[model samples]
Target: MELTYLRTFREVAKWGSFTRAAEALGYAQSSITTQIQKLEESYGAVLVERFGRGMKLTIAGEALLQYANDIYRLHEESKEVVSKQSKGTLSIGTIETLAAFFLPPKLQAYRRDYPDVNVVIQPGNEPFIIDSVKEGALDVGIILDPPFSDPELHVNILREETMAIIASPDHRLGELSEVRVEDLESESLIMTEDGCTYRAMLLKVLKGNQVNYNLSYEFGNLEAIKQCVIYGLGIALLPRITVAEEIRKGQIVAVPFVHPECKFYTQLIYSKKKWQSKAFLGFVELIGGINHQNH
Candidate 1:
């Protein structure tokens, strides 16, 4: 079996979808399928089976996955050992909010400490970030609370971030110290796109309380949402860390949420199965130091 086939199989199994594996690996979907077929042919056993729109690994596939991870980890370790004196680049992923506010200073510190090491940052939503980490496309991921649990991953809770309802300084709700869910029944809301943990939490609260409000707009970017609120387009519910500077500048006011569930944690996640390089370890330590100083 070619090593490339094993790599393709690993990505497909990690993502549980051939298309996702193709996208991550920058290969055609047919190429991914062909590689898996070759692997099955080489082993003379069915490795993957498709059911409905999703796919699952068969018993043989599951057994091989462990070996594949071991092989890949060993390969990475060998490279790291040879280059032990000079750790190379580290790829990191994070959500938009943290990318804008939380990561700059921490990343600055990391760059200052490791001037020779290169760093690449990719911004994505929680699911994409977690999957990228699991697939080994990213060395580390910083995300808001992941939606599901995976045994193959390690999660570190960096901090608990509280959500707030933000609006222009002169908006009707801006003067309130706190707003009940019912108070927003008729108000216009600007929200991030689906798959955001905080957005899901806010929706659950509104639905549970039977609050019917206007969703005036949905934005995929946090900065756009903030700008919309700054011009009095509509109020938004976002992590306080993201809007702190705006709140401090008096451009926006963060009204407290009476519902207690408006809080979630930020996490640093990585694959337990992947090899952790010296550069990765040092970068994680840098983030820890940043969090410590913040506290």
Candidate 2:
């Protein structure tokens, strides 16, 4: 019956782990259990059930969750209208490149402007980020990807990131201003792990050209790939933004790979239906504003 109990229930449902939900909300695990118990009692139904190591909502819990979602959304909107509070959380799901290279300055500026806001950056692959945004778990999703669309999401292409095939400065391909698909014939390729969007793009370009290349190594991390290239392990395909500083320092050379297929953009995405708080809208505009200022 209490609004705080509803808030606690929502967090519990989101995490599915009393321990984790408590940590996220700064509550004790016992406190989380008590609140959920009260919430279930109010509805005269067991809302959550033990499932293996964690817990999940029962049929009743799932039904209650839908109404809880509506309640919280309206509650948040009402609070914003009454208090004009710009001090809530903004959770962003992003890929490795943006987290490490692109977002530092933008985040720093946002924090300075809205010191009361709590910003959370969650790093994951594109599919995970996309799903999180759609589920209302993440406030926004950012990626360096080719043009994308989802009927449920509002996708905005912030800017085009120049793609490049990077190699050690002293490598054989360094002299070339641009590397063509055929240029990589029989070359050793250090690749990102499967499920990477750009990896798929690069492989498509090579397979379409019938270029035979060796996969010397595969890494899921950006820095590891960069380190391998710096040591002359092999050439890699990555966004120029990821390697710009190394290129400037003469550790790596951006062999400026160009192809119509490999072009990717900085994107900002959010659910079309997700309630956008003032802080949420402010962070969104601040990202777009950075794009304009940079251009």
In terms of lDDT, which candidate is strongest?
Answer: 2
Every candidate's lDDT = 0.84, 0.87
Model 1 TM-score is 0.76
**Residue lDDT tens for model 2, 1-295:** 4789988888988888999999999999999999998887778999999999998999999998778877877787788778888988889999888999899999998999889998999999899999888867788999878899999988888898888899998888888989989999999999998878999999998999999999999999999999999998999999888988898899999977878887799999888777767887778888982233322
Candidate 2 vs. truth: CA RMSD? 3.5
lDDT of 2: 0.87
Score candidate 2 by TM-score against the native: 0.86
What stretches of model 1 exceed 4 Å from their correct place? 1-70, 146-150, 289-295
Clashes of 2: 0
lDDT of 1 by residue, 159-273 (tens): 8777778999998888788877888988899999998888898889899999998999999988899999999999999888888889889899998776777657787877776
Worst 10 residues of 2 by lDDT: 286-295
Give per-model TM-scores.
0.76, 0.86
